[model samples]
Target: MAVLLVGTVVVLPSPQSTLAAWTATEYGRGSLQAGTVNPPTNLQCSAGVLTPPTFTWTLPAAGGLTRTGFTWSLSGGFTGGGTLGATATSVTVPGGLLGIGSGTFRLVANGPGGWTSTPVTGTLGMLTAILYSCSVP
Candidate 1:
């Protein structure tokens, strides 16, 4: 009489199957561009008491984003006291806010994606004399 013995073996998958199943991938990043704003040139004031001085400016091209808005600062004791249009590139200083003194004024434009343009400064002064001359009284 003869006796024979056989053995069988089984293999199991790794416990980290979910982590190994993920594959590597490549991704691209977007770029944020900057924009610019033209400074106000040839500023002039009016003699009329309630008339405000007007300042004009040109909008510069933005790389690939839209212009959000603009901020203005005045010198010569001038105060900004008006609302600007959504796309307005011009502003007028109230009569009562001007004629205080002579100084510099600046403006800057805000672009999309938190980008700002170079500030534009100008030599701003009273183009016209005060409406009420103290010497007259």
Candidate 2:
């Protein structure tokens, strides 16, 4: 007669299980659902043919939660740029803050849930150079 031993495997819930557990713990019966901050729309920029440029956009609606603030970022040709706090439906970012020439700007709305899942981004002035270039015949 011969005897054999076998190994058993156990499966565990994924990380997302925490969310479900948290929801149950927080909400009691149902699962907790995370919310998203809406990004500003109607983004536009002034003519950047001159030093610095202006940026404008429509404020995002906060569904039902309170929005804490807005974060604006500028990359390329600028240094040490800052963020702005907003409580208005429309905002116009002056040229001085945007720096000179062209660059990329991203807008994020912050709230209780978190910042916008996907930020809204745009370019100032014009696309000066291509980030990458390849040649093939």
Candidate 3:
């Protein structure tokens, strides 16, 4: 008479590692609040043209995440500015931008993974043209 016994067990599946330990962290690292650039911030032009402006800002609270892209600039002659189109939270003033007299305009608000907030400047008025004459003609 004879008898025999055997036992075996194996399990392995985990060899695709290239340095990974950060699941997803981005609580607070992007800030750019209170970026105002409304009508008549400090604009007073004449003969050159610049009196009809409107640019406002005050939506930089991406703590919850909801700002895809936003960039703007208006210094001097103003040439199309920069990066001012994409999930726009607020963007106007693209009608020739007046005759351009004063300069100073900026805004930045981009959230998610990359995060980016902190750049708000205003004060660019250039659009004055008010000539009305009607003496009972």
RMSD of each: 15.6, 12.9, 17.0
Writing each residue's lDDT as its tens digit, candidate 3 over 21-68 gives 888977877777643322112222222232244455545443445566
lDDT for position 19 in model 1: 47
CA RMSD (A), model 3: 17.0
Model number with the top TM-score: 2
Query: Cα miss at 64, model 2 (Å)?
Result: 5.5
Best prediction by lDDT: 2
**TM-score of each model, in listed order:** 0.49, 0.52, 0.24
lDDT of each: 0.53, 0.56, 0.49
Runs of candidate 1 exceeding 4 Å displacement: 1-51, 62-64, 81-86, 127-137
Regions of candidate 3 where Cα sits further than 4 Å from its true position? 1-68, 71-92, 96-104, 113-116, 130-137
lDDT of 1 by residue, 40-112 (tens): 3333333244344455676655343456676777665666633344377676555555674555556666665
